[model samples]
Target: MKFATTVLLTSAIWTTSALAAPRAGFGVPPKAPGDKNGALAAEQSTSADIEYGYNWAGVIHTTPPATGTYTAASATFTVPEPTATDDSSGGKQGASAWVGIDGGTYRNAILQAGVDFYVEGGTKNYDAWYEWYPAYSNDFNLSISAGDIVIVKVVSSSPSQGVAILENESSGQSATQTLSADPSTATLGGQNVEWMVEDYQSGSSDVALVNFNKVKFTGVQAETSDGQKIGTDGATIYDIQQNGDVLTNVTIISDTEFDVSYEAAQ
Candidate 1:
């Protein structure tokens, strides 16, 4: 990743949409609406529960330690869909969510419990793998050793003490991050979740957000960059290919809270 000598802890505990972060959709595929509460939704729930059971981790030193000089590059984000998400939601509907990952080799990744809340119904899932391109070129340097993962959470920002952690395999280095807002009681489709990228090595990071307004599955209008009206199907998802296609473990913490973990194959 590129070094931004100055690093700020962009830990703004505010609830907004998914697209709220920067460069969240540089060259990735645009996500259209998917099924309201279809099979994909069930898969998300099942996947999230399984993925949260155990922490995803790996070690990089085993592959090959930096020999001559230590160099790093920011992984390219080039998938058709957004890296993290607050899926199709609207003025009156439940919550939807998704997660995708790029390439990387790690020792351990864990989903720590945070604040708790209650919700009627919603779905969430995660995907991990390598991509041909990174999210932003100028933001970080690209290298074979570096990689990125995607995490998506859909829920009301009910005040809870929940956070997730990603640990470096070789160095045992790790970073603790908050997933959503800290509110007491929140209604489904009423709040937004912001996806973030933090550099554990230097503590610098960039943020992207998708607000509640951006999430709409059916009977609503969506605006593209060209200003064309589009109907959201709320079902389409990106695919994972080759040596990296895998689903993380998940565990349900409560009706509204849960844990998810996944690893990007090296």
Candidate 2:
């Protein structure tokens, strides 16, 4: 029933075709036509090393506005490990989930924490298959060349933090790399880029923007130990937008506690 309640739904009208190249493309390509019922019927392995993608066309201000490709937008859902269940009933108690952006290298692509996206089931045992939207929103307009790959990673806050990757549209030239710790330095497309982090504990969920095009790439850095850091090494940050103006360290209390705001960098 949850999947049925998706805020965003994708509809496909293509003639049935065999599972084409598993390369990343628009929304997890439909399972192979024959995969409807078979041994791989419930193949829920999130580590299939498959491709991910999306299509774009929405209300905006730009005239003849730019149209995003299958790679323009993406998100990663990391389902933290679940606690041991009451074997007697074989049902888990609870789980924690985190999300990250994926598209290009940490440098080439802009990634921000506290963003909202779908959490697809991947390599995790679930009582039911469903998707949840993040209370926050972060957007980025990447300037990738013809062939580029964007990777989205998600982290869980409970049990044990988990990570999954989303491979977005690529020109067969883009690449992605993950780092366990903040990197000493980073350069976007070989050009040094600056990174900054801002923290606010006012329960405000407004997105903080870090313009990628105007990076300086040389500074000490800042963060809030007791709070969330919007930008980390390899991760690009941005300003939060409200009514077309920029706000700082605020949450979108319009509905959820974690609902933040954001937009693609110009």
Candidate 3:
């Protein structure tokens, strides 16, 4: 029951569309990032290759329990006001903070919902979105400002059916979307659950990641089909490593809380 001051909200009707070309989306790891010459690329496949990503950071539940499939995951985070940095993507830098089931070891489709932030020409902007991986993300017309508390959740009714929810605690408004894993041939494996900070794709290239000082995901949790709730107790941590540079740091403060800090992009 805690919040920052000066919270604000804007609203628009929720809409959905299927996009195939030149769309923006959170993608599977293209490869582990390394320096300008692909140093990490030529190195042996260490744990970093499994834990590091060119576009993702945060923690993932790599080892699930032996008995049941995971059904849901959620996280609470404060909206970050991204600032334009020197190595900017031509005023087109941003990041996505999301929670989802699969797409970690599942490697096919991700069921997720959360927020996208961008700093263009010194202006900060945000949008709430939900997606079933390989399909482009559609936006929620929820106007949000820096420091607002947002809670996002993804639930799977079955391997192929699910729902995503995005709630703005400060505004008392929310968006919910029931989803299906149809466009994507991959269904949820229910093996990996994760919370991520991602640098997404725009067309064939990545948008430069701006400096999002610190984004902490609290109330971090997941649940099993048998009704058991889980936390970050046994999770494998991941950070963004691009071209021989580590771009972010993830600190697990507790089972229910963690923080990701931005490092400069080259």
lDDT of 1 at 72: 15
- CA RMSD of each candidate after superposition: 21.6, 20.5, 8.9
Model 3 pairs in collision: 34-243, 34-244, 35-243, 35-244
lDDT of 1 by residue, 10-121 (tens): 1111111111112111122322212111112113433221111011211011111222211111111211122223332321111122221111111011111111011213
Candidates 2 and 3, the one with greater TM-score: 3
Query: What's model 3's lDDT at 27?
Result: 41
TM-scores for all predictions: 0.21, 0.18, 0.81
After TM-score superposition, the amount by which residue 234's alpha carbon in candidate 3 deviates from its true location, in angstroms, is: 1.3
Highest TM-score model number: 3
Residue by residue across 37-101, what tens digits does model 2's lDDT show?
A: 22111112222111111111111111111232111112222222222322213321221122223
- Model 3 CA deviation exceeding 4 Å by range: 1-50
lDDT values, one for every candidate: 0.20, 0.21, 0.69
At residue 179, what lDDT does model 1 achieve? 41
TM-score of 2: 0.18
Q: What's the C-alpha lDDT at position 55 in model 3?
A: 58
Q: Which segments of candidate 2 are over 4 A away from where they belong?
A: 1-143, 146-151, 154-170, 173-178, 182-266
Q: What's the residue-level lDDT of 207 in candidate 2?
A: 17
Q: Rank the candidates by TM-score, best first.
A: 3, 1, 2
* C-alpha lDDT of candidate 2 relative to the true structure: 0.21
**Model 3 compared with the native: what TM-score?**
0.81
